[model samples]
Target: MIKEKTFTLKDNYVCTSQHKLYALFSFLSARDAYTFLCNWFEKFPEHKESTFYIAGESYAGKYVPELAEVVYDNNNKKNGSSLHINLKGILLGNPETSDAEDWRGWVDYAWSHAVISDETHRIITRTCNFSSDNTWSNDECNEAVAEVLKQYHEIDIYSIYTSVCIGDSARSSYFDSALFKTNSRISSKRMPPRLMGGYDPCLDDYARVFYNRADVQKSLHASDGVNLKNWSICNMEIFNNWTGSKPSVLPIYEKLIAGGLRIWVYSGDTDGRVPVLATRYSLSALELPIKTAWRPWYHEKQVSGWLQEYEGLTFATFRGAGHAVPCFKPSSSLAFFSAFLSGVPPPPSR
Candidate 1:
């Protein structure tokens, strides 16, 4: 889906930003997909009352809440013909809801992990306004950011503690076409066959191969105008073509939370891409009162990770998991999801 070209009254010309481009996709695809499901339920009355939950991870952090807010708004409208979607809650994992806070926390996280020195961190904290939409003209801030990049040059920035696939080149550049390339091949490099939790870091490579197979695509009815071999796991063209992003999702959260929608945000502790620190910093801006004190939640006899309940939100972390918690700690993630759907916290012992 594409954002239709529109005129800007201020400049008296057609204009758009990356955010506007992606927003069009969300409205055409994501929101319409929700409507289709709701209509399906309407046709099949037996499941009409079933609750729907919006869930996504990473960049979806922005999408999930926006979609939920849309659903919530639709439910409230008195439009006689509209479907009242029962959007019960939303689940976000390592979400990038606030670009400013997330990027600011990235530098702080790098410093805390010793990827950069304290002095550099101090300089960056004072000099940079990562929240700004414009490019920085300040040389000192640019130099500081460059140094931080250099420090993390060799590391697996996604999961800082994990082993990087050997053949994968260290990603030194900003988000670009390379982002799409890595999703299909990163796991295929010379990483260990398996981690302790039976997580295969190279699974993306296997998926890439499987999805591109003509037979497999045929079976799944996954034909597209793009050739199967050339269809990337992630559409780089869409990502690269994005014109801009909304400044913050905090206001959306505020609106949804006030509207009484259940909200839970979880993070895998080791994720460097949208680290736990970033999540914490972003959420802190909301300043919600604590409904429950922070404590370690458990799965079976062992501690899974920490959790905290606020007036309108629940925050949790998977102890040793990375960006994708289920990929690393499936059992614990299942437990978390079960509790979330049930409108309860994970039991202290189970």
Candidate 2:
């Protein structure tokens, strides 16, 4: 599935900060992905028949579904010469599906986990109308939300149960506004401190250090006439200027579900950023009929998590896992992914 092709939407390096701000939107990214896929099939024609699956976590909840929808639409609208992509399903972990539900869940999860005071939670739940576009504009709601940020400021908001990285590289002058943003504006300074290496909060810091090395850049061919000075896990410029983001991707979920695409949504119970509660609340809005009653799923003779299968979607949780489920619980995540690919349930405790 790996091949070479060159197509530029904005500039030579699509992620380089020097490009015009035209490629940051979700739909635009999806369109680019579709175009890339078509070009790949045309180049290799032999692998066009392979089953494909789209997977991502966090904000990719939007990207994955949007790309799948674009692929589905193009496949249906194909002419005799057009290629058909055999898209099978999608898998998402601790996804941000709906803005309203995600914010609500953030507040609720913070309060439930004892990260915030009851008074603060009461203030937020009372004053903050998450569904409204002007929620943060309200002074009372704004203050309450700010208090929530203040409470999370000291700890790793992405994984409340884990220790934070105290290294200089992990420190930032401004608050991380990757997930905490208002309707009208996104903070352009710091990106979210997303942890990918299980309990290690400094993984991105290490990655930044390694990727910035002159030798590393030369080895990766990243320094070849690109003028790339710095490499970050996320482009704050693109993130700040992102457009065409739908408030909710539930409509696309409904459309794909009806189209008979296999969908699985998993959550790491320990993730405070996009917590399990947020996923539950967002998915509950779909109201799909339950196909399998909720039950515990086991791995290696131990209870790994719980799962509930809906008519067109499957919801599961990874116990003791943080933002990166596989990093925290590789065996359990592997079992869960195996089940997803095979169209079966995770190992049940008999």
Candidate 3:
């Protein structure tokens, strides 16, 4: 899979270039994605008949559905000669779905997990109107949020139970520069360092070192004709300046759900960023009828997490997992993913 140029490109790339003006928006990004997919299908027409499912995690919760809607709309246009995408459904992990719900959940999660004191939680809950666009402008709310950040500063907020990277390696600078930036906008809040698999505290550091090497770049053709120097897991410049994102993608979810797409929303129960509580709140707002009652899903004769099926969607949780579900609970995540692809529920009992 190719990285999005808006976040990955460096130096003379359109997103980073001083001469070009670029605004990152979900709908625009979706249109560009549709183009990419069309080109891909053209090149690999042999796979055109295969079932196509869009999948992503974190912020992609917004992107995947928007892109799917675009594909869906295009396929249904009469006299439209666009290649038909055999689209089926989508999957998301620890997605940022709604602004108000996410903020409420973040504060509630911190308080419930004993990360913040009773007073701080009380002040925030009393003073902050999460539904307001300018909730952070209130002094009490701002102070309470600052306290939350201060407490979370010590631990890996992405995975609260994990150890922080304290290595003195040369790449520590990357870790320091990358992880600590904060934005006033709730949507631009700092994200965790990229994680692939397992719970290694210093995995991001290792990844940065490996990807920045001359030989590695050469082998991957990452530096060809580009003035790429440093390779970061995230680009804060793009993140902080992102524009045109709706405060919530819940409306998009409703539209896609009505279109009969096999939507599944999952969470890593321990992620403090886009926590499970946030997902629960966001999905609850849909008010979809329950098709399958909530219960524990099993993997390898052990409890993986809970699952519930809505009329047109499914929701699941990964026990003890962090922001990156597969990275934290690989085996359980695999079983969950297999069930999704098979158009069946995850095993209800061991």
Candidate 4:
């Protein structure tokens, strides 16, 4: 069914420190992405050991670093301005930490999954700028990789339906300034009441994936022509390219990592789109000395995940997961978030 889905207006600039690995920082914007995030940190003190995290699925993985950077940079600037903002660590799940390495991971994942064949994997892997000479000729290796991926996908979907996990949660799509009392809150005119986007928070669908054009027109308080025009600016940006042609966010993350922030990057082991291996390579460019060697930490009886702690950054892997780690491992995901929130180390893996 060729359904014309209408999207919210997109901004020309994301207003972040850098493009998230693959757009993780989509939520950080001049509009409210930055404002809300900064505010979240500022208000965290009210909650004991409040650490602000830039969390989400798919694109959010990419958004984490930039959002963290924006908060950090802005906090410094605010303190300079005689205002104080207490910013802490970042928490990201299934994050897109590296574009360069991410592509490599994607190829590796496709190669590993039965969804794609050996021929297809070879074509994708070879096409990337950094194709590894590493070859897997054994049938056993191929079968194992495929099984690993299937297990990952299975765990991911199970979590989503079972928990209040939003799958494609690009915060920009769901944000309503009105939700916040500050001027930063979503303006009714700029958006059809944000309430329209999945009023039920329990369900993960925050933004209306199916943004109906007719509903949008009807919601605009202004005349249809003017409302349509305004809506288009925000809507077009959702799925289409905005004022600029190309997409990028590496500079933003580079800014944060270079600035000495506690950047926590974790991924679902099974997710090919943003694989754990790819994240490691992305950090390799930073050339930071590994503060701690790679090791496993546990949530309970099972081995939770592995960690690579650099002086300023840390990378973690969710053992049996896909893109949505929290949904896949709710208790563990919550524990991880709590750690990010409290600057506490998770239980050691057995």
What lDDT tens digits, residue by residue, belong to model 2 across residues 223-298?
9534656877666456656654566778779878989999999999998888999899989988889999999999
Clash total of candidate 2: 0
- With candidate 3 superimposed using the best TM-score fit, by how many Å does residue 87's alpha carbon deviate from the native? 0.8
Clashing pairs in 3: none
For candidate 3, write residues 1-350 as lDDT tens digits: 11121232111112111222122333567756766676677778799889999999988977887777767766665755347788899999999877778878888998899899999999989988877656656877777776787677656678888887775243344335644433322334322233222267677778878898887887788885255568876675567566645567777688678888899999988888788998999899888899999999999999999999999999999999998888888888888889999999988888
lDDT score at residue 117, model 3, on the 0-100 scale: 98
Candidate 1's C-alpha runs over 4 A off are 1-30, 150-153, 169-199, 220-228, 235-237
lDDT of 4 by residue, 44-75 (tens): 63652453445565556545555555456545
Q: Per-residue lDDT for 256-284 in model 1, tens only?
A: 88888899999988877678998999899
Model 1: how large is the Cα RMSD against the reference? 8.4
Cα lDDT, model 3, residue 34: 68
Q: Which residue runs of candidate 4 sit more than 4 Å off their true CA positions?
A: 1-31, 36-53, 78-82, 130-237, 240-254
Better of 3 and 4 by TM-score: 3
- TM for every model, in the order presented, reads 0.78, 0.84, 0.83, 0.57
Which ranges in model 3 have alpha carbons more than 4 Å from their true place? 1-26, 168-198, 221-228
